[model samples]
Structures are given as C-alpha cells and as structure tokens.
Target chain A: MKRRTALKVAASAALTSVLTIGSAYGAEPIRFGAVAPKTGALAAGAAITHWPNIQLWVHQVNERGGLRMKDGSRRKVEIIEYDDRTNPGETIKAVERLATQDKVDFIVAPYSTGLNVAAAPVFAKLGYPQVAATAITDKIPELTQRYPSIFFALGSTTALASSVADVLAKMKAEGKIGNRIAMVNVADAFGIELAEASRPIFVKAGFEIVFNRSYPLGTQDLSPIVKGAKASNPDAFVAWSYPPDTFALTEQSKIEGLNVKAYYTAVATAFPAYGGKFGKSVEGHLGAGGVNTDTAEMKAYFAAHQKVTGKPADYWASAVTYASLQVLEQSIEAVGTDRKAVIEHISKSTFQTVMGPWKFVNQSIDKVWTVGQWQGGVFHGVASTGLPGAKPVIVKTGW
Target chain B: MTARETRTLILVVVAFALLACLPLLRHGYLLSLGVDIAMYTVLATSWALFSGPTHYISLATAAFYGIGAYVVAAGIGTLPYPALVALAGLAGAVAAALVGLATLRLSGVYFVIFTLGLAELVRQIVTWVQNNFTGSRGMYVLTSITERMIYWELLALAAAVFFIGWRVARSRLGFALRIIGNDETVAAHLGINSAACKLALFVISGAFAGMVGAIMAPRLSYIEPSIAFTSELSFQVVIMALLGGVHRLWGPLVGVIPFTILWEVIAARFPTQTVLLLGIAFLLIVYLIPNGVVGRIESALRAAQRRVSHA
Candidate 1:
C-alpha cells in the first residue's frame, strides 16, 4: 500500500514537471504564410527570387533563437506556404486559405505586380500588412487609398523609367550613344506601366523612340522583336521584360548581334545567372535593380545568403525581400505580435536590414534602387532618384 | 416511380442534403475547395451533356466561359449579379447557336479543329478589346457575399445542370442525340432533326458553362482576358469529363472531386514538379482505364454480378 502511494506521488510530480517544461519552452510557433508561384509559367523565377529568400530568412531567424517577444520569450517562425500557380484566382484562394484556414499570424506578399495587386484588397480586408517586395506600379496613390496596409518595397514605375532615361540621357550627352532608341515591353501590367512611364521620360530627355513594340506574355520567340529592333538601327535598346523574356531577349540579342551602346532589360537583369550566362558580355548591361555590394552589411549578407540558401542571392529583389522580413521581425519583436502595434511599428520605425537602414514613407518605398548595370560580373547601382552612392554609368560593350 | 428511379432520386436527394449542410461545418478551406470542385463539375458535366451525346469533341468551353467572365467584367456595377449570371448564360447560348449554325454540319476532326480555332479567335478578340477599349489590364469585381454563399450558388447551378441533364437524357431529344452519336447518317434517316438537336444541346451546354464563369468571377474578385480565356480551363474540363466517364451522369462529379484534391495536394507538396507529376499520373490513368474511373467501376461491378448469377 505504501509503495503504491509513493508511485502515485512520483507520477503526479512527473506530470507537473512536464507541464511546467512545456509551458516554459514549447510555445506555439508564430506562423508566417507565403503564396508564391511554385508551379506554372513563373516557377523558374519564383524558385530563384521568392521561395529561396523566404526559406533563408526563416532558417536564419530560427538559428538565432527565433524572434524575441516583448514578454521575454522567443518564438520560432513556422511558415505555411501555398503555390499560387501564377494565376490570380489561385492567388486569391491561397490567400484566403492562409488567412482563414491556416489562421496564420502574418502573410508575405506574392511574387509579381499583378498578383500583388490582386491580393492587396484581400490582405487589407483581412487586416494583414502586405509588404510587396517585387511589385512595381504607378497606382500608389490609389492603392494606398484603397488599402492602407499595402506597402510597396520595390521602386515605382515612374522611378524605374525616369532612372533609365537619365542614364540614357547622360550617355547621349557623353557621345557614348545616340538619341535614337528602340523600346519593347511585355504586354502585361508591369511592362505596360513601365513602357507608358518611360515613353514620355525618354521623349523629354531628347531621345527618339525609333522602334516601339509590345509583345504578349509567355511569348516564345523574341527573335522577331529583336530583329525588328536591330532593323531600326537604334543606338540603344530597352526591353521592359519579365524573367523568361529577359533571358530570351538577351540570348537573341547575342545571336543576332543587336548590340547597342546602351542595352537595358528589366526584371531579371540583376539576376546572378544573367552575369554568369553572358560572362564578359554582361558588363555594362543595364537592368531593373542594383545593389551596393561595397557595404560591410551587404558583404556579410551575400556570404550568409549563399551559406544559408546554398545559392547566391540575386542582385535585385533578394536583399529587398530579406529587408522586408527584417522589418516584419523587428516590428513583431518590438510590439509582440499585437498586429496593430506591428503595423504601427512598420510604418514608423527604421529597421537596419541587409539593404541598410530602411523605412516606409507614405506606404511606399521612399528610396528607389532603379537601374543597375553589370560591371565585371557584378551588378552595380548606376542611377537612382532617391538612393545615394550610385556608381557612374558605363557604356555597354558590343556583343 | 419504378424502384430504380425512386432509389436514384433518394440517393441524389440525400447527397444534396449532405452537401447543403457542408457550409455549416465552417471548414473554410473545404468550402473554398468545394466552390472550385462545383465549378469544375458544372463545366465537366455541361461539356459531357453536349459532347458526350453528340460525339462532337467541342473545345469551345473557354470561348463561352470567357464570354461570360467578360460580361460580368463589363457589367458588374450595371446590374445585379444574379441577373448578370442569367445574361451571361443568354450571351453564351446566343454565341453557341451562332457557332453551331455555322459549324454543326462539320464532322469528326473538322468539327474539333473548328471549335479549337473558335476558342483562340474569341480569346484574341477579348484580349484586343481589353487592351484598346478598356484601358485596364484587369477589372476588379465588387462582392460582399461570403464564400459559403458562392458555394451554395455553384452547388445549386450544378444541381440544376444535373436535373436538366436527367430530363434531357429521358426525353425524345436525348434518344435522337444518342442515335446521332452512334451513326449520324443512320440517325438522319430515322426522321430525327439532327442539326436542331445538336444545336440545342450545344446551346444548353454553353449556357451552363457561362453561368459557372459568371458566378466564379466575383469569387476571384478580379478578371482579366488571359485568366478568363485560358485554354487550360477548356482542356481541364474536357480531361475531367473524359476521366470521369462522359457517358454517366455522376461521372464528372466523381472525376472532378478526386482530381481537384489530387491537384491541390500534389501542387502544395511538390510545387516544382507538380506539372510533371500530374502529367505522369494522367497518362497512367488514361492508359490503364481507357473508359475512365466510373466506367471501369461499372464494368467491374457488372462483371461481379454476372459471375454471381452464373454461380
């Protein structure tokens, strides 16, 4: 009887100890939901630009004892992801699932501008702060009015267009290139907005658009377009393109020898693969985004990104995405998952990130990293409206 | 009613009753999935209604669906959603009748090619109109209804399509269509107005597809020409109908549910290789079961019953 009573007491003690330990250490993970194009047409780009960055951010955060809460407790991040399949309907459904089904604490934005715009209203309605890292649009005033929680991390269409025009204008003045330019844009929203914005800017800068064209998305053959641009005999070529078209246009340009003094392609030109693909030919090639790899923090980030993701980060939005996550983390840590507090903190506070000191102004990125040119196998910032410390523009070499 | 008819009615009633209670469970993901499944079921079933009966491999589903989506896009604020849905159906019926009058006489591969071309033509036209006239890339739809409401509406549409299918299958029109599918020349000689029957069925199928597209537009909250007119939608509905056994009324329901679940599961688990995996699975299923899942099941059950009778 006495032995039985002792066993019961020991069992009770063990149960109490287990409960205490569980309460102290095993807090529920803060779930972060992300919808990216895991399949369909945009899968290749998403693999490099979207998913890897999120995975790396989560891994790095968990490695450093997770996010610190205001209650002096650390909670690891658990990511719940859905493949948007590069469709707006799928994106909306995925966002709904993330918000209602998974009941996630936070949501990271989808990949492209169209998708981000499609999802913005849903995110706003659901009261989630959407930090759109790759979305480029001129509808900032309207979008902000419609959804205050929506923030644009990428440069606006005007910012990107004007920056490219300024570089071209400088080249024309320096006698590096002529005033005649050829421009082609993808027929989607992103390319359309950029094309429309850049047309007026280029005209104002005294550059004549000798050849202007718009091609549909998922276009397989850019040979005809590149051939047309070459036939125009323009001094510079500008393509507002997505990832696949960017690569295709560059390849076709090389094959067709559509070489110009100023060659610019948007969206994926800052990709490390772009430099790796063309080797020395990529030097002086201008693209959408640029990074100042000279900063100490940038150097460390590059190294860590490679180590963590087992892949080199792209020059364009990789750092930007990581910076957005940094803002989210700092905000969460500062305000402890009180969503209102987190949103308030994100809007008000300046967080140091891999992209250096970052803050949102008027629900949009105040600073723009608009144009980058490949020089010696590295993408270097060439022109920006707000960002300082840009490298001097160099004339592109002939293919 | 006969025992078999009464039993079928009871089963359908029970299934619908169960379906109607689904939203009450408050499974948000399941409700969303149900909406997708119901939309596909409507598409597949409606396609089967015409293509299965007439043996006309119509690839014009996207054309009608896109037309309906555009109707909603152009008239979202001008009329009520239910009225827009009906208008979309009317528009689809009219378009299908016009196309049917033009091409219903063509047979076999010619009919297939014409319908495929028709879809592409409509897609290009919509794209052009959207780019030039709309001055908008995509239109935003304003909807205050819940997902559950959308699901119920889709479910009701699917049920209505099923009822219409049942009524048609039992009518003299259904007899003529079956005969026409078997041998068009023989059916014509039997005093059946083959052209009229085919045109009517085609219009009905197109109208149902249009209704689905209209109802689904607001749920998406945005519609663009590319999204609305994608050939993938047409191809998916065809594949689902074929995979479920186009001959049976419940075949599409059987095919769509499993296919959607599999797609969602595979897509979520293997995002990079989803297309590859789905392709492999599709090939295996088509090769293994040429008549589809429902057809194979029916064959197996009949074989077993025959064996028992012989015993």
Candidate 2:
C-alpha cells in the first residue's frame, strides 16, 4: 500500500514535469538557449562571468518589451537553459537538444574556450550562430574558415600574448623592468595556447625567458610555482592562468613576496573579487583585459548590469560577453529569427555595443582589451588592440 | 541455446533493429540522446561483463575511454575512422592487460585506488606527449561525421557488448569468475585460473570503453587531456552499474536509461540547483534501492511466486 502511494506520486511528478516542459508560453517569445557549466569546476567562474551577464541581457531585453521584429511586433525572450556539468559530452548533448528539441530561435555559445570549441560543430550543423565571446584561441583563422557562422569576439592567443610581450617591452624601454622574465601557465588549452604564442613573440622582443613552467589545471599547491618563478629573480612575472589558479598564484606571490615590477596574470585578474580581496595591494597589478570603466557607455553598462543582476561585471570579458549578445540581438532584430539570415547579417555588419561600436571582419573581432590594471580600486583598461579610450599602463611599485 | 535463451536473443535483435531505424526518423534530439544512451549502454554493459561476476570494482573506465579519444585525436585525418576505432580498442585491451597483470593481484579497495589513479597517470602522459610532440595541448577531430553516424556506431557497439555479455554470462569463464568473485582462494582451490579469467574480462571491458570513446570523439570535436579523461565519468559509470544491479547481464541498461533521462531533466528543470538535486537523487536511489531495480523486481517476483504457491 505504501509502495503504491510512492509509485502514484512518482508517476504524477514525472507527468507534471513532462507537461511543464511541453507547455506553450504566451507572447510567442523568441527562444534563446544556452548551455553553461553551471554545476562543475568552472561553475563559480561562470556564475560571475557568464551566466549573470546572460540573465542581465535577458532582463534588459524583456524589460524593453523584447526584441523589435521587422514587422514592429515585439517578441520577448524565453530562455531554455541547461547545466553542462563541465563535461564535453554533456555540453554537446545539451547544445544538440537545444537546437533540435527545444528548437530555440537563438543559441548562446557555452562558456570558456574548450567548451565553445566542443559545441561549435553542433552550432554549425544546427545553423545556430555561435557568438563565442569567452573563447580565446590562436586558431581563429582556421576556426573562422571552417565554421563561418561562429564568431570569436575575444582576441586570439597571439593577440593577447603579443600584448603582454609589448607591455613588458615598453616597460623595459622605460627602464621600469629588465629583459629577464619568469613565466608560468596553466597546462590547459587556454594557457598553453597563450604560452606557445608568447614564446616566439617574447624571443623576438629581445627578452630572455629566465624561467618557464606549467602546472596542471585545478592544482592547489601553487607555492612551488611562485617560489620557482621568484628563485629565477626575473624582472617581470607572467602567469597565463585560469580563475582559481590565478587567485592562488597571486596569493602565493604575496606570501612569498615574489616582487616583480610588471607582474601579469590572466583570466580572473579582471574579476571584481580580485579587487575586493587584495584591495590597495593590487594597484598597478596588470592582468588580462582592460576596460575604460570611466566611459559614459561603460558606466551605464556597469550600472545596468549591476542593477539587473545584483552583481558587478568583471573588468575584462563581462562586457565582451555582453557585447557578443548585443551583436546577436542587433543581427536578430535586423534579420528576424531566420538563423541563416542572422548569421549572414552578423558577418557583414557593425554593432553598437557596451564594448563600443564593434565590427566583425572575417567573423572575428580584431580589437580587444588585452591588458588591464587596477587603478584606484577599479580595473582600468591600460592597453588594447587600439580600442578607443584605453588608459596607459601603471607600474606596480609595491605589493 | 535453450528456447528461453533463444527468445531473449531474438528480443534483443528486434530491439537493436528498431533502434537502428532511429536515424531515419531524423529527430535530432532523440538521436543525440540515443548516442548518449548507446554510449553509456556500451560502457556500463561492458563494465558489467568484467566487474559484475568478478566484483573487482575497477574505476579505470575513463583511462580506456581517454585512450580511445586520444587515439582518434592523434589519428583522425591520417587513418580511416574504423581503423582508428579498432586501434583504440586494441590499445585499451593492451593497456588493461598490462595493468591487470601488475595490479589485479591486489583485490578490493587497493585495486580500486590503483584503477582510479590509472586514468590520471594516462592523462598526464597524454598531456606531456601533446606538449612535447604536438604543438597544441588540444587537438580537433575535424571530420564530417554526423550525429546519426555516431549514434549508429555506438548502438552497434552496444549490441556487440550486450551479446558478448550474454555469452560470457553462460560461459565456463563466467562460472569461474563468479566463483573468483565469491572467494578467490576457494576459486583457486577449485582449479580455476582466477587471475587469467579476471585479466581476460578486464581486457574486454577496456576494449569496449575505448571503442565507445573513439566513436564519440567526433561529437566532442575538441580533444584535450582534461576533457578526454574526466574522472567524474569513471565514478558515474560505477554508480550507474551499481544502480542497475551489475550481477544481471542486462542490468546496466536499466540503470543507464533512467539515469541519463533523469540527469537531463534535472539539469534542465533546475539548472542552478541541479548539482544539489543530483546529489540528493543519487543518495535517494542508493538508499531506497540499495539492492538495485533488478534485484528489487526479482525479490518481489519471488515473494509473489511463494504467495501463489502457498495459496
């Protein structure tokens, strides 16, 4: 009897879920789908950098009575979301499902470089335009050639690597730093690509790489890496790292007192939490991605993002991520919900975004904020690929 | 085979034939889920072939799977797809045989720990090799293999694995392994070559896992050590096998089907809360169905039969 009751309840619960999933919504809202690593090792970072921005975009669009269609009818957004759990297999399956089953009008690309690459084929096959805002790979030319619909907004590994190299070289010329350098990278796709790109560029810039090493991703003990970099006594230190490792490496550097005039780290160094945690000590600390937070456009974007999501946007790719969405929105509005039309429209157009008036040449954004520094409690864009209104780099005189 | 066994075999074939026709429907989502279902079916069923009767509890599924993915990543353009898959299977078998010979001596927890460590070791080796030899840490398997093709490959592999499992369950080797699982010393005393039996089955399991990995690689497109050799996959397979009652030949399927669907639903319904819900769901499954769905059904049937007989 007890078992029968349990069975009855289970059956009804399953039935309800099926109904809810199959239920139609009002207003014929334009369906936007996204598969994010919401429940994995990358979840925490995605929470801050990826998911919140997506929500903010949705909220803003819906508040403005959705996207304006060509017929002047407004279509609100209804999101079909999936937690990828950070598995590539799961990521692929979720994207495929969104494309085929849910049949969403638009699909947002997954977070991080690896996942974006993993699901690119699915996006191509399903005729969805994958706006890969967070993906940073040097294989942009090849990828763009292959997947014509997929757009990479974040600058390439080569672009970023050269920027770091350029920043260090500029400092050396000013006698702020020397030619000797210490470098470490997280041994994953993102870090490895950057490191490989930088090696040739750094050599060409007449800088001797005094120390170079790579630690595996998710490695907890970073003291050895920090100590090793310090032992070389290099004038500049750079770590092409992921979020957790970036924080860990910075903490270890502070603990070990590994002083280098032009210290640079990647990924999470632009995070607001990084600023909140280290406070004044992070002033002049260089990192990946610089934004002119002082710009009125940027100021408004920041305000809207914080107001909607109740979280501050990161200094680097948050705006970039939001900008990719803006590009998608503009394309969709112009071309309607037809996937091919949007892709073609996006390929040949310029978009006014939070990151400024952006254009995709060869389906890739060329200009990007490659290096940023903390100045007066704000991560300011110190250098870029000639993005308008970038600030000058500030030297790290102390911890 | 007995008539009963023949009927079961026919049913299996009919099911396979129906599943083979899924691509014709061209429902992209169903086919995608089919690929997942078939992949896990292959992994869990093949896993049951060795770990079921043997009870060795090997946690090295990802090692063989990663090896298969890497094999495809390394050989995608140069070699034909089928040949790459075959080579991956062979590679997995060879690796398993080597590991089994060395570590199969240690039973229970010791073997589990060693097997868990094996995937990490292989991943590091792959990462090092890629760093030193290949210019990139990750490789792209840029083939025009469609999702339908991947699903079919996995479905065929699942059928082959299940057929092998059925045969192994009724074979002399199966009898010996069951005894070994019960008591290794007693099995040896009973004139069973326990080590050899365990090693043979382990190779078969690893081979299937590797084949599944190779077939699924194109769907992934991007191949890196971390993506290929996620340790979570190993644990998931184990949990699935346990949930379905690994002792039965077709038990893992019962576990895989529901788990995969439930996972999708939970992930969809509660995107942010899914992780917490997943943990809760697993705890509930383990607690409520400790003996597994198959075991519970078998026991209930036995009880009903006894009641009817008494009447």
Give me the runs in candidate 1 sitting further than 4 Å from their true place.
A1-28, A96-103, A121-127, A147-149, A169-178, A204-206, A216-221, B1-26, B74-87, B94-125, B128-146, B222-226, B267-273, B287-311
Q: Name the best candidate (by lDDT).
A: 2
DockQ per model, Cα: 0.30, 0.53
Q: How many angstroms is residue B170 displaced in model 2 relative to the true structure, after the best TM-score fit? A: 3.7
Q: What lDDT is obtained when candidate 1 is compared to the true structure?
A: 0.85
**What pairs collide in candidate 1?**
none
Point out where model 2 deviates above 4 Å: A1-27, B131-138
| lDDT per residue as tens, model 2, B189-281 | 999989899999999999999998899888888887788898988988988888899889889899999998998888767777887988898
Summarize candidate 1's per-residue lDDT along B1-311 as a digit string, tens digits.
79999999999989988998888987766777888898899999999999987879989998898888878878997898889999999989998999999999998899889988887788767655544445443366656666788889889998899999999999999999999999999998999999999999999999988888788777665565667777878878888888898898888888898889888787666655777888887897789877888999999999999999999
Please report the candidate that would top TM-score against the real structure: 2
Give the Å shift of residue B271 in candidate 2.
2.3
Best by DockQ: 2
